[model samples]
Target chain A: MAAARARSEERRAAIVRAALEVIAERGYRGASLGAVAERVGLTQQGLLHYFPTKEALLIAVLEERDQWDTGGGAREGWRLDLLGSLVEYNAMRPGIVQTFSALLGESVTEDHPAREFFTRRYAQVRAEMAAVLRAEYGDRLPGGLTPEQAAPLVAAVMDGLQYQWLLDPDAVDMPAAFRDFLRLLGAR
Target chain B: MAAARARSEERRAAIVRAALEVIAERGYRGASLGAVAERVGLTQQGLLHYFPTKEALLIAVLEERDQWDTGGGAREGWRLDLLGSLVEYNAMRPGIVQTFSALLGESVTEDHPAREFFTRRYAQVRAEMAAVLRAEYGDRLPGGLTPEQAAPLVAAVMDGLQYQWLLDPDAVDMPAAFRDFLRLLGAR
Candidate 1:
């Protein structure tokens, strides 16, 4: 029974990875369940047994991406300085960034399935960023704004830079630009 | 002859508008030419008389958006302070922004028709931004980076803030966040 459960878990992981690849190649709207199933060598019926719905598969892909980024919740302790390193790390993985950016871009349309996920995620991200800023600058940053006020911009730069870099990696050095932003944030 | 040409131009403009609405509702990948044609009261073959291909229609939609933003090439003299105003202007037009963001997000995938369009557009935008920075700050910004080095970040912040604002308009004030970014740029 234990071995059977482990095998099922392994199959689920493989399916999620395949879903990411399909979503990366085609935006989530363009990625079909059949394509993902084929990549993982599962029939559409078999894939449905695991994900239940395309939306469920998409959520799993997104959650799996976050897990990879946070190393299973290590994001709870991220410092402001570490963001630059994170950007640098992201530059090494274009496929994941492409998938995330595609989903984010597509989710803004009316009634998109991922809309709620990104909306809630940004709010939580803003709150976490505010905490990071507050921890570093003590209420107000050097520019005389509170951490809560500045957090969204910080998040915006990170996300925005990814879009630009993904479009043209050679021209836009993601890590260097992020460090430059950190300098701007630190300026008095 | 003059009346016939004028009518053709009007019909083409109507087709582009319908394409924008459809692309805004469904991403470029998910948006079908037939749907756009139907919205504009044309058969798909009739739509072909104007656009010839889906890619041509997509480009027309993109160019139309640029024309709207630049007011027919008045982007030539935009000052740094005007960027904040521009952000405010963008907030007034959610559908246009959503359409552009959706295309941009989907364009990053391999073989996307808009990929080359966006890639070239960013390079041009970066150069334009660099010129804007140089005009405002001379050889270097207050933060000591050259205009060329700083241009990408400025563009990133604007594009990035838009994504965040689109996801949760109430949580993020695009205009306010942009002004804060300007302040950060001007900080000594």
Candidate 2:
């Protein structure tokens, strides 16, 4: 029984990885379970046994991406420099970044399936950024604003850089621009 | 003859407005010329006479949006306060903003029709932002960086805020956040 469960978990992980590839290549609206299942050498029915629905599959893909980004480690304790490193890491994987950017853009609509997920995630991200700032520079940052006030602005810079970089990779150096932002934060 | 030209120009403007509505409602991939024509009380063939193609319609919509944001005037001469007002104005029109954001996101893909348009637009926007900063602050801005170096970052903040605000309007006060960014520019 233990061996069977391990095998099932491994297969599920494979499906999620394949789903990310499809999403990157075809975008969320274009990505289909049939394509993802084909990529993983599974029949559509077999994939459904794990994800149940397309929405379930998308949620898994998004959750899995977060895990890769945070290293499945303690994100709460990370400081600004660690966040900079995360930006550099994202540049190395354009496919993953493209999938994320596309979904993020689509989720803004009133009725997108991933709308609540992104909204809640961003709130959590901003709160965590505020905590990171407070830990590094106390309640107030360099600009005389409280950490809470600076947090969303920080989040915006990170996401904004991703959009610009994805649109014009050669013109916008994602990692370098992020480093410049770090200088703005007075962290460098 | 002049009256005929004026009437044709009015029809073109109406079609662009209807196209923005279709894009906001159905997204770029889902939006169709037929739907836009229906909204504007024309057949698709009549709409095509004005736009030539759906891509042309999209370009017209984007250009019109720019005209609204900048008053069809010199963006390089605008100050931070004016940019803040544009953000406030955008907040009042969520559908138009949504259409722009959705298209911006999709344009990042490898073969998206709007890819070249967005890439070129950002290049122009960043240059204009740099000029705006330089005109307001001379050689350097608050953060001790040249306007040229800081332009992309400024553009990123504006676009980034739109994504976050669209996802969660209650949590994100978009105009207030933009004002904070203006403060970063030392405009206040």
Candidate 3:
């Protein structure tokens, strides 16, 4: 039973990785289940046995990315400096960033499946960022804005920098620019 | 001859508007030329007479957006204050923003048609942003970085804030966040 379960888990992981590549190459709206299934050498029905639906597969892909970023929910103790480190880390992984950005860009349409996921995620991210800011700068940052007010900007900079860097890597150094932003935030 | 020219221009403008609506509803990759043609009351062959190709139509839509934002090349005098106003202006036009963002997101995918347009546009935008910073801050911003160094971050903040705002309008006040960013830039 243990060995059988291990094989199933491995297969599921493979499918998720394949889905990421397809989504990266084509935006989520452009990626099809058959394409993902073909990449992993499975029939469409075989892939469906694991993900059940394309939306389910997309959610799995997103969850897998978060796991990679947070090291399995290790973000509980993330600080502002740690966030800088995360930006640096992201620079090395263009494929993952491309997929995330593509999905994020597509999700703003009227009724995208990922719309709810990104909305909830951004809300939680803003709250977490506010916590990080408060822990680092007390209630008010140096510019006289509260942590809650500053959190969304922090999140925006990270996300926005990714799009620019992905489009023009040589011109926009994501990590260096992010450090510059941190300086702006820390300015007295 | 003058009347014919005016009618031609009007028809082209109508096609661009329909293309924008279609692209916003479905991402560039998911959007079909036939759908855009139908929306504009043209057969696909008739739409081809104006745009020639889907890529051409996409560029026209993008150019139209720039015209709206710049008031037909009046961006030469844009300062940081003016940029903040642009953000406020953008909030009122969610359809245009959604179309631009969708194309931008999809353009990052490999071999996407709009990739070249976005790449060149960012380079131009970054240079323009540098000029704006230099005009305001001379050699160095208050934070001590040169205008050239700070330019990408400014652009990133505006683009990034838009994504956050589009995803959750209730959570992110785009104009207010942009003002806070401007304050951060002017901080000593």
Candidate 4:
């Protein structure tokens, strides 16, 4: 039974990979399940074996993205780690970044799978990073700036930098810009 | 003849405004020309008289957005005026910001009309903003940064910040973040 479950998990992961590829190539509405299945050498029914609905699959894709972005590779405090990961991420899969941005745009509907996924994801990341801020700079919260305030800027700058990179990757020294952000926060 | 021309322009503007509204509520594919026509109280063909293709219409919408965002208000330097305009824009119609972010996510192809539009827009903004940077600092670039680097970062930061704002408007203090960016740039 364990072997069967492991196999199922692998299949789901494979399907999810294919979905990302398709979504990246074609925007959300542009990519269909059949195309995704074709990319994965599976039938539509087989794809459904993992994600019973499109919404479920959208959630999976977002969850997968969150994992891939962070990837359990936090070597230090959440801020630097997150920024470092973003720099690495932009270099690794520019396509995924575009896909992410596109998903965000399309996922604004209140009940869209991505809406809930992103809301939850941000809540968690904000809290986690905020905790790290507390641990490191609990007494000095940037002129008593709450973690709530700092968390959003950290996430926002990372996202904003990616958009800038997409337009002209060579021009933007993302890490340096991030350091500048830190300096400004410290100044405040 | 001028009367007719003025009326025609109004129709076009009306259509573009309607398009922005619908596209904001619904994704691009969801916002059909028919729906835009309906919103503007024009027949589909009447709308097409101004924009023969959906792509043309979208481009018009983007141009309208550019005007509205910048206010085409005749500023001495676009960079300074526009940075301040971000606040006005967020307040003007939150939907436009959302749609712009949505479009960025959808910008997977460098060749898509929207992509081309964004590229041109970015280039124009970069050049103008870079000129602002040059004027703010001496002829010598700051931090070994060229106009090329500064231009891209400026665009990227704004784009990135928009995504964050769309996700949670309260996530980042837009103006304060811009100030942080400037301090980092030492542009202030």
Error of 1 at B151 (Å): 1.4
Interface RMSD of 1: 2.6
Q: Mark the regions of model 1 whose C-alpha exceeds 4 Å error after superposition.
A: A1-11, A17-41, A53-55, B1-10, B17-41, B52-55, B74-76
Q: For each candidate, report what fraction of the true interface contacts it reproduces.
A: 0.66, 0.52, 0.67, 0.30
Q: For residues B58-146, what per-residue lDDT tens digits would candidate 1 score against the true structure?
A: 77888898777777774546699988898999888776677678778888877888888889888888888888888899988886778
Q: Indicate the residue-level lDDT of B113 in model 4.
A: 55
Chain A TM-score, candidate 3? 0.83
Candidate 4: residue A184 lDDT (0-100) = 46
- Chain B TM per candidate, please? 0.83, 0.85, 0.83, 0.77
Ranking by DockQ: 1, 3, 2, 4
Return the lDDT, model 3, position A92: 81
Give the lDDT of residue B107 in candidate 4. Answer: 55
lDDT of 1 at A39: 95
Please give the ranking of all candidate structures by lDDT, highest first, separated by commas.
3, 1, 2, 4
Worst 10-residue lDDT window for candidate 3 chain B reads B23-32
Q: Is candidate 1 or candidate 2 better by DockQ?
A: 1
Q: What is the TM-score of each candidate against the true structure?
A: 0.86, 0.88, 0.86, 0.76
Name the 10 consecutive residues with the lowest summed lDDT in model 2 chain B.
B179-188
